[model samples]
Target: MSRYSLIRSMFRPARTTPHRCRRDIIMPFPVGRMELIVYAAVVTGLIFAAYHTTLMDYLAYQRDYIAFTTAWPSKPADFKFDMNVFLEHKRNLMEYANLEKSLMQNGTALHELKVAKLYKPLFTDIPKILLDKWVPDIERFEGVEEFLNATNFNGTIAEEFFYLEAPFFQFEHHRMAIMFPTEIKGLLMTIKIGDCYFWSTCHHTELELRDGDMHVLDVLETEDGQWNISRVYYVPAHELLKVRF
Candidate 1:
């Protein structure tokens, strides 16, 4: 009530309680057991799925590795790089065994010479200028009359000059005919190559001898300076006759 008593009461310290002085304790947020189990199961399922997928990919890679490692080193037995005439004769000697034998024994040298002389005309020439030059005296050749009479062929050199691979014993070199057939009746004029002559003895299924199908030949030079036909490819008349001159 008094002014002095009121000032003293305001300045005096107040009594403190034990509950107010105590510190507050912190606790974790509550979660259900089912929710915890579901989260654990989802994480385990993801790990299991990843493991199986990785294992499958690894097994596929192993199979490819084995296949690459176990394969054969070289080409198969039936794989042929070239079709050699001599090799074909040796494989199946039906009728021209004797004729082919002569060339295999003695005609190696002559083959080289003929190939060297006719390389430009036979292999590389488009106009065949060198061929006309080389065979300028074709009319005066020894067997020209007999050949012309036998075949009845009356065409110029540019029309019928084509290299062929005959399957029979016609007069020619290396047991293969270098025949010039000018007539449409397939009259083959067997040229004289040394003592051998190309003659049609027998016709096989493989011998696709058309009127103008050209035989493209490749010559191979051996290690011992020997030259021979290395590869033979047949181009049909439709393709060959398309080339002008």
Candidate 2:
């Protein structure tokens, strides 16, 4: 061989051995059976905790929302006002009246009046017959007590006279106001205040009325689970004839 040919043969690379096929070789299990079981247990415990906590809370909230939406008194037929509900509302009114009386005696009439939800509505709706020849300057007074005092009337006299006559009075007219259980019926109407269910009833009193014939009571449940008088509509017996319903 020539020197160049010999040199080339010597420098030439040797043939590489064929690589083993890794595809055919089996690998050890990535995770043991015990490790897999532990992982599964942890995942299940997390799921159960989530269901009991977050999911339960969500479900409870949904139930409350449904209850609020599906409350009673959607219509006249759906409405109901039994003696129990009426008595509860009456009791609340009496308590409110007593509070008012106590506040007036303490000269905290303005504070009591500020908390009154019915003052504006009642004063605004005072019948023409109840007022004297001149319209009373009610605007100057801060509260019902102030208004009564300004009009030269004491709390007791005002409660007996104006309050009893006023259609929107908070308290029951009589201490033992006779409620006819048989005649008591619930009548639902469009709520003027807002979107909520309320029990309404219009019934003639067994006790004789000095002026009005019947009393219309609207009772609503407060947020604190107490029933209160939402509205009172005193209508004269003669006026009932003019009223379509």
Candidate 3:
């Protein structure tokens, strides 16, 4: 070739190659049917595993919800109040009272009454100081034992004086209403009791019981899968208007 022609060829753009047809291309290792099947199975397994994990989490949340809502007795009928448990509770109270009498007679230190054994086991786990309110009394107890003892004493006194009073202390008439899962951190409940009286040579007189006092119970699930009340907030009947169920 001439020197001038070679220089012109170098300066000009090279001719572009024609595009190859799609059928002309070939993979180094073509995918076999078995390989495709394996790939599909792996993808399906991953999807199922993810779905199963999500489903398990949802089921767990539902279980926790159910446990929390049904933790307390809904009504008097729902409460498994065994007469044996009640009799044992009453006996404990009577013993504690007798012990108190003995302590007074012996001139012992009454400030610290060690009657922890008398407390009902069912309520001993409740905190001594609950939601800024002290259980049994405003005065602080020496320890958990003393606090529980005092709590049992006060509880028994309240039951005898208010609940199991003269003429009409029917267990059937006692009812409890609960409003659960409020926007706030606790549940609200009310206890209703019936009152009636008999008159001499006249018809029976029925007295309407006052509106029940509502209580807000702060419940917590323990590590061992048991539910417990951490605190109780007393909401007066009139204040129920402020609460959202």
Candidate 4:
């Protein structure tokens, strides 16, 4: 063939090289933008979820370095747990009297003063069930015998560690008041003050708003829906201990 014919034939469009549909898996020449976005999102979400789960598991087991923390059940059936449950459990854990120890031991950087608490609601360890069953007369009676009975009298833990404040006041309009008989008196006690308070009862652990600076008069709950005073003292905000009214 002449050079012109050869040049013309070469210039002629050859059959489009069959586009291998699966060859470019990493950066596929996508058919649609929507599909591409969806694929990317799914990949990203999966990666993030895996990393987050690993982080949470490590926190739960190796250290309780989380602000709100709990260990989930192993079995799927028992894992009916969710984010809300975890939040509540964690918040509850934060209310321990010895949580300072846990915080120190965990060493997860949350121990520092710069910890940021976002979107947190005000929750008090206002024991309803545990107190009622354990000591029904704590709030009803007007004497030291009732107060002593309320705190279990063993005094292993002091009155100050037993009570907490919400730390941040809200529109709930609930004044810092102690609802008890007028007969509480002559009780000299130390109070703890801070943002978080640690509480412990027979078995359960919880976080509270007890930095310090309150006498006992702390209410507690029993496992069987009983409410009683874990300790009797006075807080600065509420001084209901006057013998009169």
List lDDT for all candidates, in order.
Answer: 0.35, 0.38, 0.34, 0.35
Tens-place lDDT per residue, model 1, 1-245, is 89999999998998767563233333232236886688778889999999999999999988976764454233212222233643343344333334433553586654443334333422332233222121111211233333334333323221233222221223345443433333422222232122322222221112222221223232222333322222122222222233313
Q: In candidate 4, what are the lDDT values of residues 50-114, reduced to their tens digit?
A: 99999999978657543322322222121122545444543553444244445534764433321
TM-scores of the models, in the order given: 0.22, 0.23, 0.23, 0.24
Residue 204 C-alpha lDDT in model 1:
12
Candidate 2 per-residue C-alpha lDDT over 221-240 given as tens digits, one digit per residue, 9 for 90 to 100: 33434332322232222222
C-alpha lDDT of residue 211 in model 3: 18
lDDT tens readout by residue for model 3, 110-215: 2222222112232222222211221121111123233224334223322332211222121234532222222212111222111111111121222221111112
Local distance difference test, candidate 1: 0.35
lDDT top scorer: 2
Model 4 lDDT at residue 31: 52
**Which 10-residue window of candidate 3 scores lowest in summed lDDT?**
192-201
The clash count of every prediction, one per candidate, is 9, 0, 0, 43
Q: After superposition, how far is residue 119 of candidate 2 from its true place, in Å?
A: 27
Residue 221 shift from truth in candidate 2, angstroms? 16
Question: Which prediction has more favorable TM-score, 2 or 4?
Answer: 4
Q: Go through the candidates in order and give the C-alpha RMSD of each one to the true structure.
A: 25.4, 20.3, 19.9, 20.9
> Which segments of model 3 are wrong by more than 4 Å?
12-48, 75-245
